[model samples]
Target chain A: MREINVAAITSCVRQMCMDANYHLSPDMQARLFEAAETEQSPLGRQILEKLKENLEIAAADQIPICQDTGMAVVFVEVGQEVHLTGGDVSSAIQEGVRRGYQDGYLRKSIVRDPLTRVNTGDNTPAVIHYTIVPGEQVRITVAPKGFGSENKSRLFMLVPADGVDGVKKAVLQTVREAGPNACPPMAVGVGIGGNFEKCACLAKQALLIPTDQQSEDPQIRKLEQELLAEINKTGIGPAGLGGTVTALALHVKTYPTHIAGLPVAVNICCHVNRHETMVL
Target chain B: MDCRISTPFTKEKAAELHIGDMVYLTGTIYTARDAAHKRMMEAIRQGRPLPFDLHNSIIYYMGPTPARDGRPIGSAGPTTAGRMDAYAPTLLDLGETGMIGKGRRNEAVRQAVIRNGAVYFAAIGGAGALLSKAITSAEVVAYEDLGTEAVRKLTVQEFPVIVVMDSKGNDLYEIAASKYCTE
Candidate 1:
């Protein structure tokens, strides 16, 4: 069994937090550049230009791409064959989040309560999702979820009879209703099937896919393509100025569900979808 | 549509802007988000004077990340406007000329925009790092206890924003988005 030091995990998590905020993944950047090329609307193209410029500036300056530095959300893939030493893994992760937010100058956007909504000064106690895998390596991914696009996320429960067409319609409706609120030329992640919680998790997990890649299943790929086209036709344009390309990409993830229910969830991420992963 | 607004804006200057016009924001603007806005509104309700002169000023809905070395502010981008919709009318009535943020506003806020002669401008929602370049300086003005949510006075240069809703009751987002939204 491989032994991983808790201190190492803490350090890695802190670095991941800062790195995710400052850098736009190269795959995402490439897609945005490609979208700029094919975007028909002049306004949409202009928005893409500004977006690219923003990414460059953020990277060079070592600052967050957006003001809402986001709540720390960490996805951990721990190996069953690995034993953690030195400190508690959960506490270490939280400590990393606190340090990263303070040292990296990222914003502390998390609030203590939903109703009273008191601000948590250090953006501590990150929302962590863990999966134990059969390996000796541990992997961590940190995504700073901003409120703008997060506010537009939606989940729908459909009758199994509704099928693929229903899924398409639902995804389109979510983007349509979102309008400029989610920010235009958005990347959409669709989760089909699974239980309620699983479907929501799948939607967020789908966002982890590279922006340029298409779904492996031809049927899902076709659905993704169709949805992408339809959403752009909405002309919500860049910044909702009226444009041809309103959505940059449509990504879908699915799992089997109960006979009676077809669950669908849409997780919308803005142009600055910031995330990074590390293996140790 | 061609419209012009002067520096140290007035209620009348805000009245001329229509939805869809590209706006070049000059002069000083203040920043505040959930915490500060609530406090300011509470103060106003208690008949207390605001920390700064809100008359003819634009309030950017933002909670910027902390600054890195040699920088005035960190990735300083706009937050959702709707979150502040509940408290916006009060500021508008107090003579706010414009609002800078992204997303939709409630109907009441839209009406207030028209009635109060203020315009709502949409800044690129997540383009904070790039947007920070336009901010020359930033200093907290009030509600320091709230940390990042404190009210801040920001001096900006050529800050770019698009008018989403104007004083005349036009909404760019509604108009532009409706064209492509099929039932």
Candidate 2:
């Protein structure tokens, strides 16, 4: 078995956090450009132009793209053949988050306690998810999630008989309810057919998929394309002022569920959907 | 139409604004979000003086990231306004005439705006990096312990916004959404 140093993990996480906040991924930038070109409303087009300019400024100045730099979320795919050395894996990740937010001059948005509501000073205790795989490599993805869209996420347990139409209705409803609050021209992540909690997790995970990529499953790919068209038809537009480019992309991820249930989750992400991945 | 306005916005000036008009605001504005709003409401109830006078003042619902060295503030942009709906009418009654935020205000908040001759402006959400260039200066005036959520006094220059809700209760969100709604 190959051993990976926890210190190395810390440093990797730290840099990924900083980079993710500073740079708008090229896929997201390209999609925004396409959205702007095709958007119907003049005001919507102007807003999209400004958004593009803002990202350019962020990249040039090495500043964050948005004020809410987001809570650090770490997704790990660890190989069963690899052993972690030097420190506990979770603490290493937290330290990385703490240093990243602190050194990067990003916002420290986490609270020490949900009830008492004291700022944690350094953004730490990152939400971490781990899955073990067969190889000797460990993959880590850092996604700093801002609360604006996070507050808009929803989960529903649908009766299996309701089927695809039910999924469409639920996704549309969530986007409508989000309106401008979640920040329009959103990237919608839909997770279907899992248990309730798993579905929600999968929905969030789907958001990590790059905007340029579509699901390999033909049916799911078609659904993603259809949902994108229907959402834009709402004219919620960029900044929800009104336009034809309401959603950048709709990512759908699915897993097998029990015979009686089809749990669905919608995790809405703003256009600044930031994530970075590294393998070691 | 584009209009340039100064803050401590008066009833007459606010009435001149209609839904969907683009506005660029200059002069002093205060920043407050969930925590600061809650505290301001409580202070008003207790009859204590506010950190800043409320008359005709405009408040921006924002919690900006901390500044880098030599910067007044980091990417500052409007947060969701609906979270403040509970405390907004009380502020309106206290003579606060304008608010800057993103998203749809509740019906009650819109009514309060009409009743008090106030206006609500929408700054583009998730455009913090772009918006920060307009803030000339920022300083915490109250609730300093709240960190980013503290009430900050800001000097702004040509900060862009759209008049989303006017003194007469016209709402851009409703108008725009309905305008584009497909049959």
Candidate 3:
């Protein structure tokens, strides 16, 4: 069995959080540049240009690309053969987040209670998802999710008869409503065929698939292309000032579900779409 | 058309601006987000004075990251103005003249813009690092406990924005879509 100290995880998480916030992933950058070149609206093109410039500034200055450095959403895969030592794994993860936010100078956006509304101050207790797999390594993906688009995510439960068209309509409606509020030139993560919670997780996972990639499944890939084309047709454009490119990518992930139900989840992400991964 | 303007957003200045105008604004503006706005509203309900007078001042709906390297602020950009829709009209009614944010405003805010001769401008969303260069200085004015959500007074130079809702009640978001829309 491979033995790993929880402290290593803590240090790794801290670095990932800071790194993800400061730099836009290369694939996302490539897509944004492609959008800037192709966008037809003078205003949309200008907005895209400014966004690209912002990305440059963040990287050079080593600062967050956006003020909402976002609440950290962590996805961890642990090998069953690995042994975790030296303190609770959960607390170690939270400690990593606290230090990252405090030291990296990222914004602390979490609140202690939903209604009473007190600031958590350190951006702690990340929304963590874990899976146990074979092998002896631990892989972690740190996605800092901004609320501008997170607030727009939705889950729908449909009868099996509703099928693909129903899913299309739901996604389009969500995109239309999101409009400027979501920060245009967006990435859409979709989950299909799972139950309520599973679908939401699927949707969130879809975002981690490099923004420029296509799904391996032919059927899901076709739907992704179709949705991207239709969404850009809405003329939401860059910054929703109206143009031809509203969404940069649409990704879909699916899992088996109950015979009677078809559940769909749409998790929208702004162009920033910050994430970083580490394996140890 | 590109227009250069300074603060206090006086009557003559408001009249000179229109929807769809690209504005480079300078001088003083105050920052507040959802929590700070709520506190301002609560203070009003208790018949107390606001931390800063709304009269002729522009309010930016923003919360910034903690500044490093002796900089005045960090990655300061506009948040969703629609989230502040509830408090905007009241703040307008109290003599606010200009607002900066991203996203669509509700009808009440549109009417308030017309009623109070105010203007709303959309700063490019997700362009926080670029936007911060324009903010020459920043200092917290109220609600220090709110951290990034604290009310701050910012001095800006050539801050870029597009006039979305004008004093004449024209909303660029309402019309910009049709001009560049695809079938």
Candidate 4:
């Protein structure tokens, strides 16, 4: 069995948090360039140009791409063959988050309460998710979620008979209602056929997929394409100033649900979809 | 499209802007978001003088990240405008001329923009790093206790923005969305 030192994990998490905030993934950059080429509105094209320039500036200056550095979210995949040493894993993760926010100059955005809202001085106590897998190394993925798009996320429960059409309608409606608030050409993650909470989880997980990649399943792939078309038709455009391409991509992930109910959830991510991963 | 280059905007200067025109802003502006706005408004309600003059000033709805070494600010970009809609008309009535943010505003804010001769501009929401380059200097003006939410005075040069709502009732969001939002 392999032993994973808690101190090492903490250091790794800190680095990942800082790096993700400071840099935009290459895949996302390429996709934005592609979107700029295909965009029909001149204003949309201008917005894309500015977005690309922003990414370059962030990378060169080692600063966050957006002011809303977002709340810290850590996803971990632990191998059964590994044992943790040195410190408590959860505490270590939080310590890493605190250090990263402080050292990297990223904004501390988390608040202590949702209602009566008080700002939590330090952006600490990260939201962590863990999954056990068969391996010797642990993998961590960090995605900073901003409030603008997070507030627009929605979940719907439909009769089994409604099927895929129902899912498409719900997604389109969410995009339409989101209008310019979520930031367009956006990335959409749809979770289908799961329980209420699970559907939301799956929807967020689907966001990790690369912007240009297509689903392997033909049926779901078709749905992704159709949803993309319908959403852009809303003409929310870039920065909601109006354009032909409102959504850059639609991602769907599905799991078997209760035989009687079909639950659908849509998670909207702005063009800044900041995420990064590391294995240790 | 009409283009205007303006600096250190005055109320009279801002009144000249129209909806859908592109403007490049230069000189000093201030940054504030929900938290700072609330505090500033509260101070106003209490009949206390504000830390900075609201007359003829443009407020950018943003809470920028802390600056790294050798930098003025971190990825500083616009946040959603609707959230600040609740407090904006009050400032407009107080003689604020220009506002920079993202997303759409409510009807009341839109009407106020028209009635008060104020203009609302939209900056690319997530393009914080690129936007920061335009900021030559930044320092806290008030509410330093609020951390990133503190009111900051920023000097900018050739900062790019599109006028989404001008001194008229025109709204780019409604116009653009309606074209493609076919039932």
lDDT of each: 0.85, 0.91, 0.92, 0.86
Q: Per-residue CA lDDT of candidate 1, range B11-47, in tens?
A: 6677667777777777789998887898998999899
- Residue-level lDDT of model 3, residues A1-280, one tens digit each, is 9999999999989999999999988999999999999999999999999999999999998778999999999999999999999999989999999999899999999999999989999998799999999999999999999999899888999888999999999899889889998999899999998799999999999999887789899999999999899888888888888899899878999999999999999999999898999999
Candidate 1 lDDT (Cα, 0 to 1): 0.85
Which ranges in model 2 have alpha carbons more than 4 Å from their true place? none
Better of 1 and 3 by TM-score: 3
The CA lDDT at A98 in model 3 is 92
Q: What would the DockQ be for model 4?
A: 0.72
Candidate 4 CAPRI level:
medium
How large is the C-alpha RMSD of every model relative to the true structure?
A: 1.7, 1.0, 0.9, 1.7
Local error of candidate 2 at B65, Å? 1.0
Per-model B-chain TM-score: 0.93, 0.98, 0.98, 0.93
Ranking, lDDT, top scorer first: 3, 2, 4, 1
lDDT of 4 by residue, A1-280 (tens): 9998998888988887888887778777787888899888887899898888888888888888888888888899999999999989999998888888888888999888878767787798789999999989999898888878887889999888997888888998898878788877788899998799989989998888988789999999999988888887787888888888788777999999999999999999888787889888
Clashing pairs in 3: none
Worst 10 residues of 4 chain A by lDDT: A116-125
**Candidate 3: chain B TM-score against the reference chain B:** 0.98
Better of 3 and 4 by TM-score: 3
Chain A TM per candidate, in order of listing: 0.97, 0.99, 0.99, 0.97
